[model samples]
Target: MKIRRANKEDVTAIVEMLANDALGEQREDYKLPLPDSYYRAFHKIDSDPNQELMVAENKEGIVIGTLQLSLIPYLTYSGGLRAQIEAVRIHENYRGKGLGKKLFLWAIERAKEKNAHVVQLTTDKKRPKALRFYESLGFKGTHEGMKLHI
Candidate 1:
């Protein structure tokens, strides 16, 4: 498997992966005639210098995994820069094969290369397995996070 920056053509596959799970069924739109909002968001992310949308592909070049990394410059923590990992997903056929670990480690290493002071991500509390996987990767659930949908 090879990990690389995602191109516009990879959006459809990524969206399918995003909608492959239980939680994704409610939040993601991977149906026929997908919404324009998806492409709009992709364009914004793709054009942003501080954002990276990545994909993992197999020997046949099919996208089987995806994640987004956003580098944020903050005034806090001695003017530190942080890299946030979000929207991580692996194709159902590719799960439980240690590919997720490789994808995550690749993101972390990319963050380090960018001189980020920290790497952070948040998982829905509903996913116990994901929480365990993250903790095993050395992430600490030290802070409480709250969000209000617009």
Candidate 2:
């Protein structure tokens, strides 16, 4: 398996993966039900310098996992930056195989290379196992994450 930066060609696969995830099903957050043009626009924005979309591919080039990293520049930390991880998903069949850890570590390394002050992510409160997994990776629940849908 290889972890690489995503390109336009990987958008469809990534969207499918995201849509099939638990949070995706609950929130209907992905543009999967929309036209290809919508995904095109999303891909364009995600691939910009300020944001990053990465995928984990097998030897045959199938995208089995994906994660998005957004750079958040902050003033409180004296111009420090943070990498916010979002939309992390692994293929259904590929769960329980440590692929998620691999992908996450890769993202952390990338964040370090970018001199990020910290790496952060939010998982749904219902996902207990996911919370444990993140804790195992040395992530702490430092703040209460709340959202209000507009």
Candidate 3:
């Protein structure tokens, strides 16, 4: 599989992978034909200098996985930058084949290229298996994550 920056044409496949899981099926609405909001968000991400929307494609050129990486420059941590990984999803058929780990390690390399002090991500607490997967990859639960929905 080849990992590369996602183009506009890959949005639908990326959305499909994002909606394939239980939590995603509840939160994503791809059934009624995708709305403009998705593309709009894509454009915003595409134009951002600090953000990257990436996709992993198989030999047939099908997008089988995707993730977004954002470089956050902050004053804390001695005014360092961090790479935040988000929206990581791999197609069901592609799971457990070491693709997820490859994707993460690739992101880490990209982070290093950007001179980030750290790489961070947040996973839903409901996914114990995912928690285990991340821990297996050497990520630690260093802090409690809280959210306030508007």
Global CA lDDT of candidate 1, please? Answer: 0.94
- lDDT (Cα, tens digit) per residue for candidate 3, span 35-57: 88899999999999999999999
Candidate 2 residue spans exceeding 4 A from truth: 29-34
Clashing pairs in 1: none
Each model's RMSD to truth, in Å? 0.8, 2.1, 0.9
- TM-score (C-alpha, index-matched) for candidate 2: 0.90
- lDDT string, candidate 1, 1-150, tens digits: 899999888888999999988899999978767788888999999999999999999999999999999999999999999999999999999899999999999999999999999999999989999999999999999889898999
Off by over 4 Å in 1: none
Cα shift from native, residue 71, model 2 (Å): 1.0
- For candidate 2, lDDT tens digit of each residue in 54-133? 89998888999999888889897989999999989899989899999999999899999999989999998988999999
- Where does model 3 exceed 4 Å of error? none
For model 1, give the 10-residue run with minimal summed lDDT.
29-38
